[model samples]
Target: MSLHLRKPSFVLISGLLLSLAFTAISLISYYVANQSLNQHITTNTLPLTSDTIYSEVQRDLLQPVLVSSLMAQDTFVHDWIEEGEQNPEQMQRYLKAIQQRYDAFTAFFVSEYTHKYYHSTGILKQVSDTLPADRWYFHSRKAPEEFNINLDLDTANTSITTLFVNHKVTDEQGKLLGIIGVGLASTTIKELIETYQSRYGRQVYFIDAQGKVTMQGSQFSGASDIHEVKGLQNIAPEILSSPEGSYTYTNDNQTYLIKTRFIPELSWYLIVQHTEQSEARITTTLWINLTISLAVIIIVLLLQHFTLGGYQRRLEYMANTDPLTGASSRHAFEMLFQQILNFAKRQKHPVSTILVDIDHFKTFNDNYGHLLGDTILTNVAKVLTQNLRQADTLCRWGGDEFFIVLPNCHQSNALLIAEKMRQEIEESLQVINDQQLHVTASFGVAEYSNDETTVSLFNRTDLALYRAKSKNRNQVEVATESAFKTV
Candidate 1:
């Protein structure tokens, strides 16, 4: 059942009466509201913004690392390296495909044994133990980690600096074969970081495991290393060790609140810095509040309707949304589904539901870990959402499963749509937590029948889904409209 809220007229009337009472304790209410706003900024706004920036960074920047991982795992690269790397043109073509497909700045491979560097354009150069410029190749080969991100100037491909993700290639026996990876233009990344600052009104930058500031906007004056930054220097060691947390520090006599998240894929720390001093500079707002305190009746009477309605809308949204995937909540879905069913019955239009389940999701979750699983789930939801029509409704039915309602669509058309969605997912690779993954989904389609309850219809759909899974997964199965079974 949906909530029925009283009209904002009631709130306005109540607020007008309260405004008169507020004229008596206006000073006290001003202080309380000021404190509440400050707390809200720090507690809710900053952390929420931090999480958003973290996700965007993962989506935008971590892709190259994932691409490099795929390149490392490709059999063609393995076979070519194993065969003595004689075909330079073939390797160049392969590298070119990787670069163009991903839109990376450059793609390259370095052979440790032959000390030869192959770029998308062909052979770039040969590395040597003595050359300082080629130290990155030797360091990548000697490092215990499977991959390394080196930010350096690219003299071979572009004259500008680039961030290269170098991943180690190995044979079936796990013996080191070579190194392969892609480069991203530093300028492009810097521009992206700058946009984050303007968009979120926070200073966003990245620091390596050792505290060196590896990435930041061009307009930002963040120090080269966290240790050199005024306030962070004191807590640099603790910040480096902690996986994720919010820390407060004083920098240049200004108090700053910073949230740190350890991005394991890139081995970098995402630092989102917010200045509390700006909010604390509430002198102007405090004056306005005190001034409004004198005329509290006018202010509350003026804005009460907008404030109450906005808050009610926000609360309703929070209640109706799935926190993890941003899809409709089951409660919200039920309400919407019933509305659609009623309308379809009246208009005599077809309505169909598709049940989508990620095949072998539990195994993927177990092997790759929950973080990767959540990332995959989020991406899958985005894909489904993008493909949905304006009238169609998609809901997070449960973990790793999505329920889609296509109004005015017959079972056959819905089945075709499901097949399209399946093909899109099947053809794409999802990279998460520094690992590349191929994801495919199974779908079950069902059309609404006369006087059928939601429970009975979905039960049949679930049965069809079970059949699809039983038939080796990643295929679509259909349920007859005439079938009626309680779940």
Candidate 2:
């Protein structure tokens, strides 16, 4: 009886297997390619691009700063200011020569003794502390840095936005004479940023340390503050904290690769942002290919009826388990958690989760190599599995992280279980490179609340985990009941 259907079943099963294989191949190929592209951008392309932009900015903007510094140090300018700035014609001629020689947009000097402003056009205005327009000179006097960049109105150019490199002028006695600086129209900096953005196809902008957008390419002209920019405000804290580096920022469900370099000459941060939309396009293309492959496979399978009991079981196991640690994958964990959540909702039983993170996992990888990291991860998974109930679900939640779902458990019980697991992991040792390596982990436990979505519950647990890591690692933290009550 079985032999009669064997041939037909074999043909159908083969077709189904081939379909799954092709779909998996397409997905894996897309994943690898996307990862390679992102890695290339993060490691090679972004740094090179940022360095190139930094060099270009220095080449263009450094001249004004140098000119301002030179003018500040000039003996003639110092003597003129010391002479009470009485010779207006001489001052005007001197300013004109400096501005024309350097091809600067404008040149200016403020006398500390006379409290007067002298420009290329001569005695443009008085240095009044009470006037907002004249406040730049007062502020420049109090500034600690010898050379500073500021955005101010260019009176010579009808008060258009200008980049001023203000340099402090002091006499031989080290007394402050006044401020000497050269101005360049802000449009010049904007054009430079626009040119770079167009050439590199990256969003370019200049941000001061306070996160104020001083000058930006036309693409980002809508917002003058980094905190107001969409997809950027979310990661503004990280950006302002880091002096120079690369970071990945996620907003509106899209991720952006942000590279930042500091421009000391301008006292501003140069930011180059590129989106991962290319990866999304690649995934979309692969899905289209997979859909075609699936259609072909379905047609072939329908023509031949299929069955592969053992092979199907193997495939199911592979799909559900993490290849490296033999623990449940994120997908499998989500499915199981959903089932547990449904049952708990009906039975009025509680479901809890513990998010675990290995402490200093990156250090382990750096010191012992990635091979040892993999070994340690596998061993840690084993330790977690041995400590959990058979009904509990243990999942590999990406690198150096694991999630354990406990059904029919309350917050207190979940915390106890997490603490036990944390201790077990701390005690567990791995012999790598002939050295005994003891590992520790941080745990965050949270019980699901009534009417709470899975995402909200997970976020609460993640917050607890973050707190645990922040306070101290190798410990367990429980989410506050009030925190989930609102969720």
Candidate 3:
């Protein structure tokens, strides 16, 4: 049976149907676009905010503490305090001398017999005060002698507070002559965060490994509790257990980026957070606004695609590229190594790598100047590129070390490639203005093992390189079977 539908009012029906279809599409597109905008904000902005916060804390607070710790362990300070207690005034003057070395400290003190102490702030306080029962100084003088932190209570008031770090000062006979206390103002850290916030418009927090908030950014009006943010707690456990990590979350429709890094100096975790609203919102809005103003949006995108995109790409290349050597930088090489490892796993092939470091590089640089050394590196790079096949890659792993990745290569092939690279570099010596710059490299080769992870594989190669250097330079050494058997 053939059934045919009647189409008497075709024009009217068609118009009504088309109008409804267009309205539905318009509503759906708007809904989808808005949802995407929200997701984009959540995914992108929060992470950027987290990174900004983390970097700021690291650059400002953690770095200073590290520098201070280095200065604290200086030989000069140790030698100056070697004098006995009979010369108490001399000891006081010695304290003054040490204090004068660094401008970072405000109050400096040495505690000998708990009560008998010598204090000096030659730059700020003219006459040093030896006030007893100083709660702050006494607290700093306590045991667990590694690092003593105490709040200065005597010379320290609410407004002008001081944090003290006391490290034991020992005599030549290894006798404890007292502890050296370095007073750093709490306000200095406060001002640091303030300055960082002013520049980056981000909030910073100095949280310990246990997720306790040590310091909060003055710009932050949020709660002081470390556990205030659920996302932070979840990340804290994993990141504190490991090296560094980041987490993103959304709260009250606002995106937050939280990044945590362990600051080795003060044994603290530096947490940084930023509002990723600008990048996320702008990118999303521009995409949505594209439909509304298609012509203008297209023009803007094209302009960015050509100008800003190209500029950023070029900057990234410069940053991750060795200019003179024409090879990838250490960072870029690591990225490539990971990619190659992944490919090797997927293809079920062996991945072999080598690290070659130039021998006597410093001597060459000192004798012929850095300009000739750079030229030598360039020539070495050219030789490596010329001799090696396209399948293999060479990168500037460090100043004078190059990493070579040979995918799907066995141990025999790997050694051959490493030796050939060494030979090529040695033969590529050039004389720049009567200065003979000869280049020779020591290589460490390693073949991929089924049980080895990517990180461990690199470590093995590094160990081999160390062995090669130890056994005299300008040679190739494969990682010992016993060495990697355990790994």
TM-score of each model, paired residue for residue: 0.50, 0.49, 0.39
Backbone clashes for every candidate come to: 0, 2, 6
Candidate 1 residue pairs in clash (backbone atoms < 3 Å): none
Ranking by TM-score: 1, 2, 3
lDDT of 2 by residue, 1-487 (tens): 4644675678767776776666665555665778775765677556756876786677667779878987998866875666666568978998999889879899998888777778999787777888887778888899888878878787666659998888899877878988898998888878878876875667898889899987786678446787886767877888888879888877668778889987766778998887776777756755664575466456545533323444455557868998779989998788888889989999999899999999899999888655578888988888889888888999999899999999898889888888888887787654555777778899999998778888889989998999999987889988887777765
Tell me the deviation in Å of residue 403 in model 3. Answer: 0.9
How many pairs of residues collide in model 3? 6
TM-score, cand. 1 vs. native: 0.50
In order, candidate lDDTs are 0.79, 0.80, 0.62
Q: Candidate 3: list runs displaced more than 4 Å.
A: 1-301
Candidate 3 residue 475 Cα shift, in angstroms, is 1.8
lDDT of 1 by residue, 1-487 (tens): 1323465557657766655554544344345654565564466556656765666555556679878998899766876687688768989998898889889999999887887889888898888879988898889989999998877888485578888888999887889988899998888767767876875567988889999988888677767888988878999999999998888888778778888889876688888887664445554554554454435334434454565566567668867898679999888899899899899999999999999999889988778655567778888888888888999999999989999999999999999999888888877645556676778899999998867877877887888888888999989999964555434
All predictions: root-mean-square deviation over Cα?
Answer: 14.1, 26.6, 18.7
Pairs in steric clash, model 2: 12-306, 13-306
